[model samples]
Target: MGIKSSLSKVFASFVLKKIESWKFNAVDAQERTLQKLIAEAKNTVFGADHHFHDIKNYQDFKERVPIRDYEDLRPYIERVVEGEPDILWKNKPQYFAKTSGTTSGVKYIPISKESMPEHIKAARNALLTYIHETGNAKFVDGKMIFLQGSPVLTEKHGIKIGRLSGIVAHLVPAYLQKNRMPSYETNCIEDWEQKVEAIVGETLHEDMRLISGIPPWVQMYFDKLSEKSGGKTIKDIFKNFELFVYGGVNFEPYRAKIEASIGKKIAAIETYPASEGFIAYQDSQTEKGLLLLADAGMFYEFVPADEYYNDKPTRLSLGEVEIDKNYALILNTNAGLWGYSIGDTVKFISLNPYKIMVTGRIKHFISAFGEHVIGEEVEHALLSVANEEGVEITEFTVAPQVNPAESELPYHEWFVEFSKAPQDLAAFSLKVDLALQQKNIYYFDLIEGNILQPLKIRTLAKDAFVNYMKAQGKLGGQNKVPRLSNDRKIAEGLKDYIK
Candidate 1:
């Protein structure tokens, strides 16, 4: 192995030692982490305002700080954006990772110096953890492509503003930067179609062994690579390609297409990184869910998903989390976010290791008729129907059709973009409706009682989702279709693109 590979091995070995131990006592690790965070920020304006010094433990901290959403914290974030120091964090934030969340239009999340290292380390360990668990390090010896947003940053107020991906590009270690593909200039190309072509031109002949990005964008890269290489599979062109590092959206919907594009089955790693903080990663090769970071300079709280919309929901710490129950995630991180609801819903599959699978988003759900269908249920239903019917659905969105003028009874409306359309479209729609009915009893009751009509499904033209996202100017990098919406907004918007 080369010097860089050798160094990586050493670091992985050292970090894995702690990870192994922490899995046995994640509660203790979480407690210690919370204490450390409180101690570190005790003197900051937010800390003092919340009486952080008076807090002794988790209970005290929780009692002092009420759970807050982005809207509740907007005043503080605005202050920080105006170049205010020590307003929320101990120091002035170096950058703001801008993201358009489902509920919030454009959010400027602070990225502090203290939080930056934590983000970087968690991401590094995610890859290293995969390597340690699987003993697959060859990808490190060759070039890797990280399909992120532009590395070019724009100054906002006094701090730099850019997509989280772009901000992270500059933080990648210099050694790996040497082997990273797609020139910096090409990455900054505003038009995604133009950028993909630029990437294809530059990396067509390079030794690309690893690729990382959100699944949709990476699939675009894989498609471009295949097109440029004259129908050769990615494996055929980059003979050494091994690992696909992906997150930002669930990979199930695109798995068939991605595997088909790659021309072979390859190992995939999932991460739970957000503009708020680096939360979790897949640490075990065989395990089902991501292992939540216990000592990662962040404190976590879980509000039961069902109670999330309530005026006063029950919030629990790491020790109180239960297996199989969906909870809306709340984070108190080193980035100066205190009791911030990041809007993500998760379900823990393993308590010992604190492994969780992201279930959905708080704002992204369909409960117009009290069916309360979530992203997790929609994803599960989609997977079941896809597997049973042997179809490939690239992207999909669901919204409630509640207008009596349009339909006799209220029903769910589904708009699907299929790369490989099913031959029997009616049968496919029936299967989707049946799967959702089976998964959600309330939905089933609504249909059985004739209170709501059967779910409506419409297949969209290929690239319909791409076109829709492009029209919204959010076609790439962490932007994804919100699986469920309360009204017919998404479905109505997509109607114009129906085939």
Candidate 2:
């Protein structure tokens, strides 16, 4: 390690000691335990039996290894393509988490025995972080609703298996397990398409307190709740649900609408999670960014946002990264991924190496009209206007569409499900325009005052995301709308809903 990196570790140790002095926390001991675990992590990934054993330090590692996404593992995937068994991280791997992700085609990420701890550590510490920060033991007593995939058996793998949804479910303490609600699939829907239909139906009688998962799927449940209760909002069904923790998308876009329908500002929190690991989570719902689980069994490396796709992408270790700078992360974990480039981008929100705000995915950007548009700028612009207007939104998606019919301007449409209707639609639209114009100089210069079009926000008809999921055949498992889609296919799909 370099002098600066060494200095960062010393500072981290010192400050954490101070934090451990707080009345409710006991993490200083956990920090010492983590030091031992890190040594084990290095040994496991770099030991004689595994791959990439050469590098002893971060600087000695290659400046840029040939980048590969999940598709690059096709050769390894071919080994077990016919259910041949004993593939990556074998030992009769308990079960595979069937995550529904595709751009080119369907991707089945195999979560094996060795990789199991990665998810477990992530989920366990997620709660530990919440307790350390909030001092709330209510989570130990009350019902926690997991807005996630099914907990059913897998015939394909032929294992008495676990889903990603319930793998984390099995790791929690037995005390907390007693209070959990059975999955929506177990109680309500067996017909697959109707799984969402059942999960929402089963949640009707439960007193949900701390709910977790993506924003869109939760919205799908709330929409169903509204319909089943004769247009009554979800608050009507689960009257005592005070904590509303959501993530996996930009929460700011739908903040106003969700709040409006729910009758109060649901204590919300954001998280950054993946099949690889639960990377980061919010310690307090009121905090600005997620308090990253730094000591979790993963070594994180970040490549700057501007530098990600380059031949020599810059990589920063935990101690080397700075606040407010955007970086694409590389991973080395207990999960057997080394120097792995996970595709998400995050901006550090504070001096603490463990806290960050996920700004956007590095893949989700639009430059169709010579105006480069990214998720962070769009989120900032929308949040500025929404905060100003005092709007409460629960679900929304954004896109950049060139107006084929209208020659004057390229249109940026924000399809929103709103809590309140603004009396002056034009005024609200203009506010969104001003927020955008101030943030992007390319956009500002391209269309000065008159030429630039204002944003269009439209309220969904209760079950809009549900309708989208049904149309896309993504009604079950891990299906969520891309919070920002810059493609024409989705734009055409939303044309009727956009006003």
Candidate 3:
């Protein structure tokens, strides 16, 4: 059933008023204010036998139990997956999300009905906050295009379900939703090629106003739309949209192409979401970096970037978190997940607890030769080169490789497909290399002797990695290509193609 727009709008208005009342309330208390709520969710959803007897505060709770991760609740999750009734947790997952994080390999994460409220509420709060701040949501009448997974899971009979993008498609407030290409309902295509075709078929229509998804997928979607119309842009297809919201990974690479395709100064909203929980988001023009959903029904902990690998880590509340420093966020959410490290890193952009900017992923880094390089550093460096060269290459990936043939020189290789090109490779590569060095002092020292040189930029046809991920049976959903990697295997394997 389609969501009633009037009713949803009324509810949204009410929700927005309440969120505005928060006023950075996430830092009002040193202890979690929603401990009772999280406890209630835990006992009701997980069927927990034990209850908090004496703990009166966050510190007490911290002392009583250690933090946790996904593996910690294998027993409960296993039961939920098997569809066991009357389990401690209440929400049965509609479907498991396909995510391959640092620890979770080829993993299927259950999205419980109970846990989803937190995700939805937090996301709503962020979106509303954006509206309140920008005063421009009315531009499209609250009709949004979210590039999320389809609700249908691809299963036997080869029935094609919406990928993670499809799931989000179903989850949005209905009037904002569309029957865009590759309807998760009927797209029996699982192969990326097939799925892309299916989505392309639907996207060719002119009704798709406002789009959201990982930048690559959105880029691919636009490329398909353009191809279908023989050089027409998204502006020609869904010319009505005035805003574009995207997160998951950096969208800077494709920012130019996206703007050109849309033919306007598209309002870009960046969000920070993880499998464990949706941590922070920023769409509000008044604020920079995403505001951590600090006041959500969750207890939070912050581990300084340098101390993430510490033997005995010290955790802090939002108030205690420092500004401009990176931290590995820890959360004790309503889902009964505690001390769960969501893996995404962030920077505090403001004093308000909710303000943060996603720095990068914890696992996706290039440090093969002890020269630690991450997403933001590489992205900024590339942007600088692009600016210098006056080119727009939005799609690129970086991998660390030691070329044995080149006397085992540890070099950073970049595979970049450009909408525009820099004036010179030699100068651009040196500038990128210096930028990386200046960003990471350690990298600077390592490259001082020319032991490791600058970056390599190579082009690819628009849907190159899209086709690659599709070939691996990973094309249809939340899955995305890693932006940076330390693994020599992935580096060497994708190297030839980078050239």
Ordered by lDDT, highest first, the candidates read 1, 3, 2
Tens digit per residue, CA lDDT, model 2, 1-499: 3343244345444544544452122233334433443445443313333323454455644432344566665554444434655344333345555554555265445555655675665555555555555544444445777766555555464544445665566566554565676553462343444665676667777877776766666666676778777888767777767667666777767665566567677666566777666777776656677766555555577888888779777777666778888888766544444466667888888754357888777777655666666788877876777777776555557777576355666667777656555567678877876787798787787667544465666656555666666777776455656667667666567656544
lDDT of 2 at 250: 74
**lDDT by residue for model 3 (92-190), tens:** 455455566456555445555655666767766665655555554543443344545545555422222234444454565444444343455434444
Cα RMSD, each candidate = 1.6, 7.6, 4.3
Cα TM-score per model:
0.97, 0.79, 0.85
Weakest ten-residue segment in model 2 by summed lDDT: 22-31
Estimate the overall C-alpha local distance difference test score of candidate 2.
0.61
For 65-147, candidate 1 gives per-residue lDDT tens digits of 99999989998899999888888888789899988766677899999888889889998999888877777788888988888
Order of models, best TM-score first: 1, 3, 2
**Best by the TM-score measure:** 1
